[model samples]
Target chain A: MEKKVILDGNAVAASVKESLKERINLLAQEGITPCLATILVGDDPSSETYVRMKGNACEKLGIISKRIHLPKETTTEELLETITELNEDEKVHGILLQHPVPEQIDERKAFETIAIEKDVDGVTSLGYGQTAFGFGVYPSCTPAAILEIMDFYNIDASGKHAVVVGRSPILGKPVSALLLNRNATVTTCHSYTSNLEQFVKQADIVVAAVGKPNFIQGEWIKEGAVVLDAGYNKGNIGDADYESCAEKASAITPVPGGVGPVTISMLLKHTVISAESYMSKKSATL
Target chain B: MEKKVILDGNAVAASVKESLKERINLLAQEGITPCLATILVGDDPSSETYVRMKGNACEKLGIISKRIHLPKETTTEELLETITELNEDEKVHGILLQHPVPEQIDERKAFETIAIEKDVDGVTSLGYGQTAFGFGVYPSCTPAAILEIMDFYNIDASGKHAVVVGRSPILGKPVSALLLNRNATVTTCHSYTSNLEQFVKQADIVVAAVGKPNFIQGEWIKEGAVVLDAGYNKGNIGDADYESCAEKASAITPVPGGVGPVTISMLLKHTVISAESYMSKKSATL
Candidate 1:
């Protein structure tokens, strides 16, 4: 059988941005500018890089970007107050809090404090629930991006056995729930799971999001199984051993060009959606 | 191996109700009475009977029971408005709209309209997501009832391969999610599933919620698997052919006396929780 073609995540994301320029223009004409508020705490190297990339994307899409820089010693109460202020800011259509706030902060509580309507990053439990139930709302950017790719590629997931090898609240759980909503039988395995290979060997689709580089061996993959590596390691290494698996599998997404770029694209898309919903709410009252 | 004991559903439910009375009295001292709102339309004979049973259960537990009677000709919008009214009513804690609303009404919309905070019955998508995620305010009563029964009977579901044959939003889907949360590998099958027997035969636990009687045959069951039948069919029949499978299975819940009674008990429990929550919210301001 002929090998399936590879897809470049950055190229796909660029196309999505190109498509959104027209919508952004329309919104500007109507006197609405989509605004994204990015909150960064401490000077984590990777987080700074990610924030920079997102800000650049916002500029490219003609959306207004506001950056809130906080020190590493910031208290939970202070951070929450800042988020509350953003919630009340009419100009702010979406709020994005960079991950790994601080060791002293309650991350879950911080995520929950984001207004459900303004949770453009879709990190709140309510937002994740809405997405998992297919109620047509913003989903967490990365998982939503993966779904977009699957839909764009016309992959049929219904009735397929999907093994998700991570159980993180934000990524693994939500994505697994999403796959289940699409009629795929989903199994979520974590560090606590025994016999990991047994589960991977049975999946028609394998989604590795454990953050460990090359955690999934090529030998465990079922022939022709659709592989999605939602991991980014040092030097662009992925959760899956891509080189060996690419030769054996029918289709696989590369490390840097796979899920990374799509995440920001989905984030930009949500900014527009947030702007639209905010506009509709405002217009309805008028 | 010794034959497993079967408990009567009505007897189990009565025991649960009796145990909950002490808590009800304690809450009443604080001017709070666990309350349940039962909504019935068109006087469907079976639905009316079920509603009456649930209300009676509330009365027996020292809980308040409120009934909303609507005409058969009620439109989806009208029903939604009524539910919205109940959702906003302080005295109404939990709302139960009997399933299979008049054919003219959109059932899912009516169910989804119930506020998650007031959804003690746990039928809303929010409730389902919470139950699936194992962190929600309420779990769907039928699934909770099943888990309660298993707990009471000392049946361990951890690491079990649970094959749930049904994919309805309320029952099969939520129950499978609950099972997965409990560390079981759960596979949910529906009407469209092919080779259903293959999955059913491999399960350590089989939950048959498909309404068709005798849908799961005896030979398909493993020699010592536990069985939970949540089906309520006409003429008191269950999804499983009890006589044939009862002999082979290590433990089995009889149709009339198994999952049926426990569901009503769970519904009553949810009402109490809702009432407690309502009282606490009020107390917080005072």
Candidate 2:
């Protein structure tokens, strides 16, 4: 049996973080600290846990993590005000509004409030457009992570058939655009897509982002195709049936240790980038 | 032999114009005329013809046409200054910088300068992003025209497999995003795509936007597919071979009188839409 390559997220993430250290040190010498302001609405336990993990990751990289937790009843106006303050704060390098804000709050409106330069999470419409146009400063972290992993493993997307399942604004759509920008033939499939498996069978690269565990069957994967599962569902399972998919895949990402870790690392990396850009601009003007 | 339906651009364009007449009249009653400002740099005969045709189209619709012709030696700064003046002009509802400005000018920068509200041609990066997000006020005229034809012919894009050849920023990319938003499974294929025919063979609908004449072959199209040719090459030829494709297509748009006419109509339509929006905002303040 031929040994399949395990595209390890931890190793990829370590490589990314390892790269940022030198840049982070360079910023420190300039008396600058890359700061990320994470705004979390309401007290969903998972959201809290995710927020803490992000802050810890930033601290570990010598970056500042400013966590702003709003009450469940926070209004859209209130949230926008908070984002505006962050946008104006010279110390803040990036702003991330954790997904799924409480019902009353207008989520998209909050996202739009993030200044373009500081939108490290790449949640704004302008960022999405720039990403599609192949000149985005910070693409959504998960999508960026997927590309980073592929780069680490030397998986060339050019001239390949990349089928992306799901069309979430932050995930599926942007990733498809990114791949297409890289010269891959891209097919964007969603819930309304019929005969989805047939499309999957044609893919040289499969990106599973449907948010449902085991949604993609092994039989759907083309032989020797690279599979990057971006879904993290309940019980540490991914969007694809790992065991069966691994059997057919030339390279596969394991769920818990796959795309998740690298996603946070990308967020950190973007912050450092933002800080570097800010310092350069400040120096140039002086 | 089964007869194929000819998706007539003249008929669809007339319908769009007819619908806009009432809105144009409503604005006229308020003593306001919708205006489009078209900027042409240098004397490219084809571009001059296009600009004149657009200006003539605006005049026929009772919309004011403002034409700005610059010399070949015009700098990017000069073009941007012109766009800025028009963007600030309340009378100009839409602004179009005809494609392919002189090589010295930065085209994308000029496109970006068109105020989002006045970007009726949908050339701006923000407009493209908004179109991808499915809420853009105005999409690129050609892409919008493709959707207009589909709507006019009662062709539903939902759940269909749409293969778009070419990945041009304004045409191919926006159309793919439009179709995806309509719940169609969209594949964006470019020159880099290997086995292009196999992908085209699977499409329920084929959109040919590649600039080459007769680039998409008849045999590559799936049986009973709807073909939309957005390409208008030399001698009025489209991207797909008309005779061969029409033989296999259930419905097809002809090159000369197909997407071309409707594209101009969409520009007219978007200008009217922008004018209406402007009026509503004015009335609210009053």
Candidate 3:
């Protein structure tokens, strides 16, 4: 077989950000800055790193990043109050609540408190619904990123058999919804799925979002299948056995630079979009 | 081969209605009658019959049925206004806008106008999201009916490979979400799906919602698989060629009395549930 194509996330991310620079400059002319407020309620090192990286990305793109680090013991009510404040704040174009808050916090309730307009991370139930219905302004970023990579690489999803492993609400479920909306015949598989390999072997496209390292093996991949791995495990490994699967896949995204970079870029893009929406509404009213 | 089991809809629907009677009486004691307000736009004979059937079902259960009939030329704005009125009405426990409004009406916008509290038919984008997340109050009736039948028959969805043929917002999509929530590995296929038979043959549970009579052929069925046909086509035929499929299937729902009766029962059940919710809130406030 000929050399397999590596789906480059950095290239996709760079292109995405490059396209946004012009839009960001337009907002700058209107004296408005695209702002994203990210709330981190715990001190998990990984979550902290993710937040900082997002914040840095925002700064790089001429957007404002407002980081709110709440103590681990914060109550759900307090979290709701903070979200309400951001919802009312005219300058905050986007709001993101980092996942895995303290055990006591009602996480879903807190996510619900974020106004739909500012839910840039797409954690809200309403946001998820809108995305599933196909008119959502901002889908959950990771799912959006998966599509961005596909679109960048010119991978057509329409009329294809795409098997998605894992069904996490943000990553797996939303991405499945996105692919389905694009007219792919989507099979959503999880740990409870029986005979998983049988389904994977028949796919035109395989999406690995199961989170476990090397969960999807080489033999599971069909010849010339397009593989998009959305997993980021310890030691930077993805859900699929990369070296082996790449041998069979016609196109595959590597772990470190595959989906993660594009995900942050999507968040930034959503913030800019939200800011533009606000500016347009402001202009209309003026 | 031993005879296949016929999944009887009348038996399941009767049981559901029988269970609701006591709850309905409790609401009556509280001086609250469960009410469903249905908005029917235009004079499509099929839609008219459906609305009337739902109204009749509500009356049979001692629930109030408020039917609003509008002309073919009704604009989206007029439909939205009617929905808003129902949303604000304290006595209306549920609101259902019959599908396939006239060409000029913005059907989705009108569906969105019904308040979340009154979206018993599960038409709104918000409701679809809630259903996907597994916390929806009322799922679209047909999807709910499909699950009700599965539960009624004690067929477990967990770990099963379910193939859903159709992607309609109200039927195929919601049912796929519902089955996924129940831990079934779900493949959502539509007309765009390639080699539809191969997917169907792999299913442990097959849901036919494609709206075309005999679309799912008998040869596509796996031996001993459970089939739930949600299609109601002309001449009282189902999506599945029932006679042929039944021979190869372990259990299947018949068209005329199958999913159809249970669907209306689910609507009635949802209206009563909404009324019960209303009563509890009123009591708590008191």
Chain B TM, every candidate: 0.96, 0.99, 0.98
Candidate 1 residues lying further than 4 Å off, grouped into runs, are: A281-286, B5-11, B103-106, B281-286
lDDT of each: 0.84, 0.95, 0.94
Docking class of 3: high
Candidate closest to the true structure, highest DockQ: 2
Model 1, range A144-175, lDDT digits (tens) per residue?
88787787777777888888888666678778
- Lowest-lDDT window of 10 residues in candidate 2 chain B? B1-10
TM-score of chain B of 1: 0.96
Question: Which lDDT value does model 3 have at B7?
Answer: 92
For each prediction in turn, the share of the native Cα contacts (below 8 Å between chains A and B) that it retains comes to 0.19, 0.90, 0.92
Better of 2 and 3 by DockQ: 2
Q: Which lDDT value does model 1 have at B39? A: 91
List, for all models, the DockQ compared with the true complex: 0.36, 0.92, 0.90
**Candidate 3 wrongly placed segments (more than 4 Å):** B1-3
Looking at the true structure's interface, with contacts defined as alpha carbon pairs within 8 Å between chains A and B, what fraction does model 2 recover? 0.90
Give a tens-digit lDDT track for model 3, residues B123-165: 8888998889889999999999999999999999999999999
Docking class of 2: high
lDDT, candidate 2, equals 0.95
